[model samples]
Target: MENSASNNILDFLIHLDPFDQLPRDIVATLASTASVKYLAKGESISFHAFCEQRYLYIIRKGAIEQRTPLNKLRARLGEEDQFGFTFLAPLRDSEDGYRAEAIDDTLLYLIPHEHILDLCEQHPELHDYFAATAKTRLDSAVRSIVKKEDKGLFFRSVGEVASENIAVAKHTDSIMTVAATMCGKQKSSCAVIVTQGEVVGLVTDRDMTQQVVAKGIDIHLPVHHVMTTNPILINSEDKVIQAISLMLQYNIRCLPVVSDHKVVGLLTTTHLVHNHRTQSLFLIEKIKYANSISALAALREEKQVIFQALVESGVSAEIHGQVMSMIMDAFTRRIIQLTEELLGPPPCEYAWMVAGSHARNEVHMLSDQDSGLVLDDNASEDDRVYFAQFATRVCNGLAAIGYPLCSGKYMAATPKWNQKVSRWKDYYSKWVASPEYNKLLSISVFMEVRSVYGKSELVDNLQEHLHQTITASPRFLSALTRDAIETSPPLGIFNSLVLEKGGQNSNTLNIKKFALNLIIDLARIYCLSAGGSLTGTEERFQYAVKHGTLSQASCDNIIGAYRFITQVRFKHQLNALTQGNEANNNIRPDEFSSFERKHLKEAFKIISELQDVAKLKFVQGP
Candidate 1:
């Protein structure tokens, strides 16, 4: 039989993160060695550099504020939050260490540093939980949730797995020569076609068999005749999962791995299969072959599993968004194909475009449909009627397969949104010339458009025109900046989260409206001002840095802030789904732990600072 005090400590430790992953026997051992101490409000605790014995302090009640020697607030810890991690290592005499002051009368559980060291030796994963930065801890938290088998695969880079034996050929080389090179010395399945010392095209074994041999084209002709010109390329530094995503998206088995415009290696589907098939890759394949609406709907259940897997695997936020967006793309493409099968081929060329989060490849479970149809200029009145009916079926089909219809009627089903290429150009021109508040909101979403199905050139032309128009109009950029900075991060005085005051979400914070949207706006403003068309938030920041619009340090801080906030929002939604609750953007402050609360405040502060920077840069003085 256990005493009540011991039982209480054990229960609390078992429920906390990182510890929650520990074995029961270890938890019992930890609880047995822990001692308790209480501090009165305004009392301070300090650790000397010369001290031989150190303890990891976990707050059991009240609050403890940890600060640097200069009195800068490093973190604020409340119940169940631990500190003293910095003292785990040996300290030198000249070291200016941290101080913890009790903000309220606090009770703390102290575990010897020696005990923690031994536990870490026994369990290596525990080391990440005690990492110095919030980002590292959040990453570790993500890893802790993943199944053990999947851990090694997610952390490995594409360069490590990609084959170094890259088969190379010149664009002027004969198709037979390329095939012979792939088969003979290179032992490769794909050959890169180089022209003037730059990679111009890709010729795969499939191309040799399908395009050259099957079509009975002259094998003596240049490989460029059969090769895919300007093929998709991946950087060597990108993660393996991203390579897997690109393969699944383009339905290709091979990709050229480039470093500084030079072909370095090749990443193929076989490489991914050797590692182990990720659920995301497999789900996309299943989605491609899914013939009926019911079959596609059944695949929806697997999406939650895939979402959980991706979250737990500790992949970056960009990868998360890309995977989810690819799934949406597959769904849309299949729906469009099925619609075409039912209602004859379209009379003219059209592009089905998805805007907003989906276009940015930042979609999550809560994403709604934001799509439009761009028809050719030559489309007749009868063509408009045909496309309208086609769009209705596609929208309803998407709603049936888990994606809800656009609440604002921004979908192709709306007659106003489904229009000709010339009409879209006029719309973009008008929006830029006169950007009122209501029109700016629509422009912000529409500007991030990507063609998911049909002719992509239509969307590409419109996007190019939009960028050209904005580049020429400084007033439009200023108006966009003013709109971007209109909604600041929900930071209350003293760096607290400003919660909703009333209605269904009373006492909760809308993470999307306050944090995510603000970051997105800043990214958009920076990219638009720079005349860069990248849509993803992180990529936009990187583009800004590359274009000298944003400093490297500022870009890094904003990226970190975006990743942390996005991870928090994702985990919240994952938790809600697991517990059979409706997943929404609203998060109650009470639901956050001390670790989350601290980092979230920091993230909010970063967003606010960046918003100010955007205002100063884009909004000229009157």
Candidate 2:
């Protein structure tokens, strides 16, 4: 074997699937036994049960569109995807024939059939990966990725870990009685308030001190008056991840676990802290009590560790992002608190709002600051000055912890973003009215704003106003749709490179820019066009489907693509972190396993198909 060709082949094989699961020496040996082949566009390779020579064809570059004997399209292959599984079986068990035509100028690595058989024999674990069925192979590949990840943290039901030591009292019970009950022999931190055998509210130990002792409230008053009404509750059968997400979303220490509308137990931060995997709950508690910026900054490493745990927990991307965003929100809220201690109280009412991914609860390790301030409309000039300084400190505090400052300067620190409520509404009205003014970028980033701290109604009002503005303007959706489809996903991978349309190729793929953002942008357009106010990407798609703007099948397909792509991005970043490099979105083409490449090609096609659907529905439709 030629040294250069062997080295190149080994490099490519080392990162591809089933091969990746095998030993390096074995892969190198197989690479040495492989031959290279090229096919021009429209060229076809005809297969039959018996052939003069047989080889497992792994696509090295360009596209191969497989077709049945009748000329119906089968599967399209791209770089890193293999297509010779059916003929790999021993002659006694061989399957029928098919034709593989080059959809583009193509390069392929042909490993002698004997080499694949010999390797699979030595590594029985890879049997399914190279089976005749594509679905089985893909399933095997996905399972391999989760083999080592701890599935318990994400899969365990709430009832498994929740403490059954909850204190329950009637709505008519006096505060003193419920408070005493909480601290009595049961020694629970919270009590569930019920009425007519129906759980109605919740009150925590801290509530006793702040709402009763500090305020000098009459302890004899009904617990309902002091209890948090309609408190967040979790079902006993729900996954622990859902419980964690709820705790983070509502910023509560305990959740009443109800079975059949009856309070059964309590799931508290204390219960979760006992499980090493749920350290996020413990981390949040630490953030709430940190007295200074330095104290809060020291916990940055812990945040990353929890992120690592979350990814390793094998949770879905939506849950992963929700957990991460909750951490971000905790940091942001605490930083504001400490800043206030340093600079006196805020002069007037204001909401510290987060935008983009943060607002959508889809933040990842790569997320940056997309934030702003919404002041009460009555805020004076002096109040504006005060809030501006306040914004700077909070932004700087976030940067110190981990989140990078937005390169586009969309943070609260930017003067334009720190505005009175009316001005903010006016900004949306003007943006929607003048889509021709090229306001898409600004609007796209801030369009998903949600208040993380202070008056949430401010952000809610703005979201409603945004939906109304989008609904009233006929040109806005058309313009937004046009902008949304401007960037098409890559035309699949080239040799050790990503090939976008227009003959451009790069060694590293911008997974966020080319793939993820395109889906995100489309979701935004669909949801907003349907007069929906949902923010998260998955939920927005669900909103579109529920509102009759998107089909349920499309919603499920796109959301599946979104999850797969997100998982790959996170895995890439995780791999980088483990290797001591800074995590990023730029993924090297060769870093993909054969399994990932196969699925990614499908995912890319899904995005491309959805983009076409958007063009016809929003751009070309009424």
Candidate 3:
């Protein structure tokens, strides 16, 4: 029995991330002193109500449900999962320990807190393992909570709200009667025409009014003749917010909800619109009142509240980005105001320009500052000197307002970034007209450029001239493709995930760098080549679809990948912010489920395909 328990304990320790790297002999020594026990469903393991004895636990079999007042099962732990690191905190603060229960009949290996501490005290490596990875498990737990909240925006499943008594119509039914039945029921906005339980077409109020009534068609005409064929529809599992956005976007009043292409129910704008309006008002108010750093600090308090609010409102990510962009813009304007007061008056007329994320108006949660200036090209030499000094003060003040300085030396205060419009045009032209690697990399920065708080005509004219010159060069586009190609995705030989080896983020994949940048780069190229003028990745994809530069399937894959990565990155940043750690984009692969891992791989493959297409079309050699 002792040997059996020891084996289970050793197995569990081998899988625990920080301890997993230790030599086998050391792990074996630790496991020999561990006690493995069985836990029945709903049993309390770390009952602070009973005792203060600290114990480290490794779940060997079965699951544990975390109970909360919100009716939330915070997590269900499985085999080889670790828990009960609360011993690391002071006893007074650790009293609110997690309550564990067996989701199924289960087993756990427990190491006495005293023994664990003793072992760590003896071995520096073991101490490092526990110390470094303690926060990781906590972070993982918090991130799990954040994802639950993020996905909660659409948590209502089709099973919960979908109709059982769906209205149906035959292809041969009279259009007038179908319309009358829909109007009379007042509950049904659409009638699904089914042939052997397979969807053939969908008829709605708009079809009757536009196709039958206004056209003077026969009232007894077949419904199929008037109804829309192959209507755009959504799956029953989709969130109501998405359904509402689709309706608003396509100008359709209702969408058919399908299950395996069989009509399950009809979703209407009325249900979605009511919910959307309520949520959007709350979000707008929250952002407006987030006037100070202290006010914005509440965002880190509720992990995913901000992102969840944006997603559930069903606004396009582009619009959602703009909302964040506007908030940051207001925040920075205040920063400039404070700085101007500190430095007295500017010696000359100059326009402040927000660059990078703010310039693209793609500032979401956890973004830093990027800005510059456009002064009158005709300013005297002495006037230019004073203006530069004023610009430096503004940039420094932005840093004080919680906007961290750019690590890449791309801020407005720098002389290279701040310049006259005529010189800016010359700088842009040199890069666009040249075919060199460094210039192409610099130009890619311009891919997301937008004028914020500047003389509008100067920025507009600069863009027009730059766009005209860049598209004129086949060699420049090729060089851009080459620059984009350097960041090869971190995947194994068979396209399995490749994780970072060491550091605080060992075993995590850098999601934003390897995954999202591919989509962003591809979208940037598409926007440049097609004469489309949007900076955000989603807008570029939308424009590509409308202009026929990208097929529907290609657009779907690209947008899906972008959305998934954005969601993951936002959650990662939220977790970092909560722990008072600097925000970052790296995410551990071990934290994701098998299905999520699969989707990440598929997204990377789609990006690789897009790059291949771009290489063929634009990455031509000299």
Candidate 4:
């Protein structure tokens, strides 16, 4: 029913991002309204304030170079790429230097600026897509992908929104007295039971009604007799969503907030549900109750949806990483439990430890499995066999459900990694003592480890031993410094990007390798040198600054750089996913707008400066 030219335009629009997300009717209307123009080689089109008509230009068949009035090349755009965003809004000055010149005989589709404005008015979200700067468009693209939901309140901290004036009672107090205390304070529905300033239990009105009155228990009994001992608690600084997740997971109506082991406040489901949506909380609950591997795997898609929502809501990278890591922890713990049931219980105590990003609580969608098994020293050969088989099932099951196996085989299934407590200490000692190239790789991966399941003391003891050894050996830290700075941030003279040469990712930057990893390594060096055990990169930097090992100014600069680079990387990955492409860290320079280009160059400069600082402080001789 359509001509070949119209069909061609429609096809092109359907494949590009933002446009790809538009309704079919909108695409059809765009195709109907678009006007075509041809430009000969070396022909230039200049936009100025006096032009009565304005247009959004899309290159249809050839290359176009955008330049400033000073004739500096700003960007190169090809087929399916667009420009002329200034025309979408009114201009104040004619000096705004933007001109497009065709590199060859070029075909272009030009849509009137008024049309774009009309569409933006009809769909308010599209305004970001048509924004004048690349950063704005990129941000808008992220926001556009998320379905509309409750936005406010999720980002607020639990302590800020939680009820601070909570009823408190001693464990020795009578149940009737505790209930009277709660009633006298009209705002309190729950009473926290404490003994010598430590929260020992929690008693709610429901608990009193159900456990006391319904069971015909004496009201004069001490609250501890009817209280839920060792009740789950949340730190005062935790996010509101975390409280919601905890409540849903444990089926508890309320959680006591604790700081310094003392109850500070109370957070109930009523507080969270009053103003926030609990999609992430409910999704985690679904993950917990998932009956089979297939059902668990299906929930992986839902995880992406929640991730998109969180990113769209504009939460910081730290929060994003924390939420993602919590989800991964939930998945890993549940999978281990399921595997244990299928393979039968272990013969000895063992700790399932996660390393790298999961341990640092910095997980993203592309995070792979980096886990190890720490067995009790009492384990025999038979115990090793059973644990090895169990580890295989857990690792294989994780791969089946979206998380791929580690390319370096750092997972628990590897016998070399699955070891007794003493053996793990020996491994750390050997790695730290030698500090060889290959051994440094092992140390870097295994250095920041956290126990996800089983006896946590096994992992804690190993961590303490590692810190002691590293602190005692300055040569090892020097070697680590050398290793950290070996791969410097890719920056060229005159503020250009130094891209990978002649590989599959040629002309693209490996963001993880050149930018993110450098910041991570610097953080690790500073923290380890200070004998600090913090894992999160930002926190590590802060700890070093707090300990006077690193300057606060340098820490702030590096952290800002780290956050920007991470935000850009995440947006790139999000864009790939939105377009149904496999998400990766390889980003083409042309994909970035001029604004993003400027900031990215600044971030790379900051990383380069920090690498030199590390080299001066640790790598060079005194």
TM for every model, in the order presented, reads: 0.71, 0.79, 0.53, 0.67
Q: Write the per-residue lDDT of candidate 4 for residues 463-523, one digit (tens) a residue.
A: 9999999988888888999888777665432123433222132577788988898899899
Q: Of the pair 2 and 3, which is ahead by lDDT?
A: 2
Candidate 1 per-residue lDDT, tens place, 1-622, comes to: 5667767789988988668878888988888888889999999898667667788888888877766677755556666767776567667422357788997899999889888988989998788666544445555554444456665676577888899987999999998888889999789999999998798899888888889878999989988898899888999998877777788678888889988988999988777765433644567778888888778888887778778767767677888898888888998999898889899999999999999999999888889999999999999999999999999999999999899998899999999999999999999999999989888977987989999988999999999999998888889989998887877665431224332122132477788888899899899988877779999899998998899899887787788788888888888998999999989998887887655764576676567667777888899766
Check candidate 2 and list the clashing pairs: 17-594
Q: Put down candidate 3 lDDT per residue, 1-622, tens digits, no spaces.
A: 3488678677767767556667887788888888868877766554453356667777666765544333333344455555565455456645343466675788878887777787777765455334322233222322333345444434566434555445688888888778777766644767888777777888877777788879999988888888788778789888655564455335566677887877777766455546543244233334335555445445333324544465443344565576566656655655555556666766555667666667777777657767667666776787777767777776665565456787776777788877788888888889978757777666666555665554666677777888878767666667777788767554321112322122122455777667777778888777777778777787788788788777676777677666655655665566576687777776656666433443454455457667767777777765
Ranked candidates, highest lDDT first: 2, 1, 4, 3
lDDT of 2 by residue, 438-508 (tens): 57888998888888899999888888888888888878989888888888787554344545444257778
Better of 1 and 4 by lDDT: 1
Summing lDDT over every window of 10 consecutive residues in candidate 4, give the lowest-scoring window: 494-503
Cα lDDT listed for each candidate:
0.82, 0.84, 0.63, 0.79
How much does candidate 2 score in TM-score? 0.79
List the lowest-lDDT window of 10 residues for candidate 3: 494-503
- Stretches of candidate 4 off by over 4 Å are 1-151, 156-201, 205-217, 222-225, 228-267, 270-277, 493-496, 499-505, 620-622
Better of 3 and 4 by lDDT: 4
Point to the candidate with the largest lDDT. Answer: 2
Candidate 3 lDDT score relative to the true structure = 0.63
How big is the positional error of residue 481 in model 3, measured in Å on the Cα after superposition? Answer: 1.2
The number of clashing residue pairs in model 4 is 0
lDDT score, candidate 1: 0.82
Model 4 lDDT at residue 224: 94
Off by over 4 Å in 2: 1-41, 44-76, 79-100, 103-144, 168-187, 193-196, 203-229, 436-438, 620-622
**Candidate topping TM-score:** 2
Clashes of each: 0, 1, 1, 0
Which structure is stronger by TM-score: 1 or 2?
A: 2
